[model samples]
Target: MSDSPDDSGALHLKHVLAAAGVTDLTDVFAIRHTAKNDGLPDLWTASPEAVLAYTREQDSRFRVFPENPPRSWLVFMDDGSHEGAHRSRFYGAYENDGEALSERTELNRSFHIKASPLLAAMKNRLVVEWTAPRRWHRRGTLAGDFRVLEIADPQVIPFVGYDKVRLTYQRLKAIVDDPHYSRWHSALSAVKGIYLISDTSNGKQYVGKADGGGGILGRWSAYAHNGHGWNKELAALPKGQCEHFIFSILRVFGPEAIQRQVDEAEGHFKEALLTRGKFGYNAN
Candidate 1:
């Protein structure tokens, strides 16, 4: 019964119910199922309140409540790291509205089915996660399989991976445009650094310094706007092709450092990154 849904009309929820040893799918308590879907671009990127608003669109009558709870539960998996693959797995769902289910905050949350048979079975086979996309729809009390939808892979999970961003010219735009990505933008803005921009097309590197009032974010903003950021050597190539540029932090400098020191550090990275001859894009 752990098999994923096939093109056939096989219901995944039925499989879950069977695994949970539930026979009749009667007055099943309908829980909200809000998952990442195609119709909304920034669905996962939204703030918690925004997400709550999106999920609360369902009719109040169908929403899950402690007093009018469902005897069973179900879900709809639209997209995830599974690459549109769907299968029942260990999950944890919670609501902090002082009602829905548990009032425990993210900092003090744990998923364990301490109750006997039925509740314990629900806990083991239940989908638990904060990623649901809709409030519990009371109408969907019947066990049903989730529909797997295709979406662009490598989904962007906010606050998950930012420190590792090797700034590309395109990604630079996101950093400037999206406040959610402001953590890196703010950190980079407060420091000085020697950065490396690699012309991924030719493997050429451009070593630059950002120690002025603007800091690294200021320097990168230029590249995001004008690819190559007015680098003489990069100017020789076509403009549209600058999309191949890759940026990354080479070295950071303390505020106490002077312009001359930053220039020296930039010089060091220029040599290290070999932006000189072997695809060296820096004319200077």
Candidate 2:
């Protein structure tokens, strides 16, 4: 029942039930015997609303058991036959724990009647309810045409104050230079975007788009060494204080679109760093 449905059969049943105005079993089963006599599935499906309406009518006297775990319920017939209806209540239909049921066999046997037809009707309704797809559901947006903007703010946090930044850069360089580092470099190339490491503190600014060679992590490994200007800046941060942020652009763009986007983002990153003020503008 938890599986997504490929068709609309489940929805059709809900619509039919709503139209019948029969919400409980009393009114639902009270219909002419001829209507009830039809095949159980057919009868229930034919007017589900009526059945639901009828069940609601009996809400006052129906006794549900296992108050804590909510195992089952007993619906008594007005005829006072002592044999009440025993319906299983499960959080989910697919969870079948026979061991628990066997333990409670005595209680079940005493309260439950062999009303297969009624049980089948109830099961059918539950199936419909469980299987129906949620209406008006929206899927999350996929990352597609992503762009990396450059950081233009010259006055923003400079990669100079922290000692950890320099150490992280050294570690990164060592990681990328080793033969084993090729795989890591390849992985970073696939990342959609990379944040320029501005300061060891709260100074993340999206700066550039990575060429589809790998992911952000991979790219970091690649640049960890090489003593580039950015690497030197990162190396200056306090040990263990430097951080890199990478964003993926799977949903937003084709190659050309992402390139332009990244360019613009880098520009914004620069502007933000210069204007934001916390990035060590006065130190140097």
Candidate 3:
């Protein structure tokens, strides 16, 4: 948020933009921060964009793709207006599309901002402190509107591990919500090990493991996808009951670990939790 001069006493959007291949500030597109609003979807709202400065192409429209400004967006999330809270999220980054805009015009609205190069190795690592909060407070096609007054190279916030952590079912779903889960891939579903599912309402714990192709991510994805995860104990319950369950990893194993080893580990956890111990729910 510093105001240090950049040859003009004050840096405009064009100065920092040049670093990201966006020479013209006019070509920028921004979405109103809909976190506190009703029109936007849950993905746009619940996302940490309000405090993280994440750029999105979800409900965006453009006249056409151009060259100098690049067919990409130096997207800025509106930082003011937190539904009367009136504070800034103060985060920014380059949200470029790896694919050609011309090829994507015919695709779905969700397909607009792929930034494939940043998906794997980069993994949304372009987050930077572009400018001080309150700068891009409003939407406009003017020079100062979408301009970034500062740029601090960028930093990476990676997903470290799985042990010593517990999660609600909703949080588990949030981690693998597709576009914003690069950090989760390393810390979550990729973890294959014995897990515990506890019904917060009844205190029943179910033990399981994922030694399949998807590892822990693969196993939990079953729950995320269908709620029951094909378990007899879970299937007997009504739909949406899975959302009330709290999930946690009891242990982790290597991807190359054999199914028998995982099955044995799962058995150990099931015995430890004692599904028959009045608080357990293991049918096997």
Candidate 4:
């Protein structure tokens, strides 16, 4: 293992390990890289041992090996100076060959820095380590960290599919009132067939294609009410929280057949939400 300053002149390290295959550790692990100080690319590494040592030094936490030979292990690191301190920003290690550890595996585990707590404490350098639990799986570890940054807020517009449709009933109720409502009202009437936004627990927000249309209400309602439908779903949901908002809508298909339009619109919405890190639905 070796350490050096990266392009931004931040201290970074890399590790190399002689392991069997990639799938030897945990099923899936993430690497978080933060800075020893506040900045970008705070985490860096090129090897597994480096990741392990970094995590141990930074957090001083470890888990007992599970398998006879220890299928996988992970390391987490941060640059903030605090004994046993947690930082939201950190790095992680994963098995080398793209293998991940199964959560079902019984392994003695402990954590020095919970991701949320770590993110709350420090804004400096951080890193993490992850391992898989299969011998035939990938080998080695992957390293990276996290950093806080600001992004520009997108310009959004409200979409009213049916001007005549009243908001008196719940939003889904309004949609169920008329199939034609989908034809006129869209999250993005300005764009043509694109309806990208939907109402969720957090008001108007981007939803996946699978969660697009009025389907979002159904799925969420199912989960919220222990499998209920319609009014019952709404009744079961926390009161005053079912209100939906129009975050942004896009119309990619213009005056196409209804089926074709649904397919196209759903695809476009899925692509858009995915690009923004909002993968909420199970497409399958």
Best by lDDT: 3
lDDT of model 3, residue 23: 45
What TM-score, computed on C-alpha atoms, does each candidate reach? 0.44, 0.26, 0.45, 0.22
lDDT of 4 by residue, 118-194 (tens): 22221223322222212212212333222222111222212223221223124444443444444333432323233
Tens-digit lDDT track for model 3 on 175-224?
65664566557666555788889898888899987777777788888887
lDDT score, candidate 2, position 99: 24
Candidate 2 per-residue lDDT, tens place, 140-169, comes to 110001111121232222121111122235
Q: Against the unseen true structure, what C-alpha lDDT does each candidate score? A: 0.51, 0.30, 0.53, 0.33
Lowest lDDT sum, 10 consecutive residues, model 1, at: 148-157
- Number of backbone collisions per candidate: 18, 73, 2, 71
Q: Give the true-structure RMSD of model 2.
A: 23.2
Ordered list by lDDT, greatest first: 3, 1, 4, 2
**Candidate 2 displacement at residue 90 in angstroms:** 20
How high a TM-score does candidate 3 get? Answer: 0.45
lDDT of 1 by residue, 1-284 (tens): 34444668454554555555654545443343333353223322334444334443332332233434343333222223343343232222232222333533433322222112343333323432212334334333333434322211223223222223465567677777676665566677778888887776767777888877778888888778777667677677785767887777778877788888888888777776677775576766
> Model 3, residue 182: what's the lDDT?
65
Worst 10 residues of 3 by lDDT: 116-125
TM-score of 2: 0.26
For every candidate, C-alpha RMSD to the true structure in Å:
17.3, 23.2, 13.1, 17.5
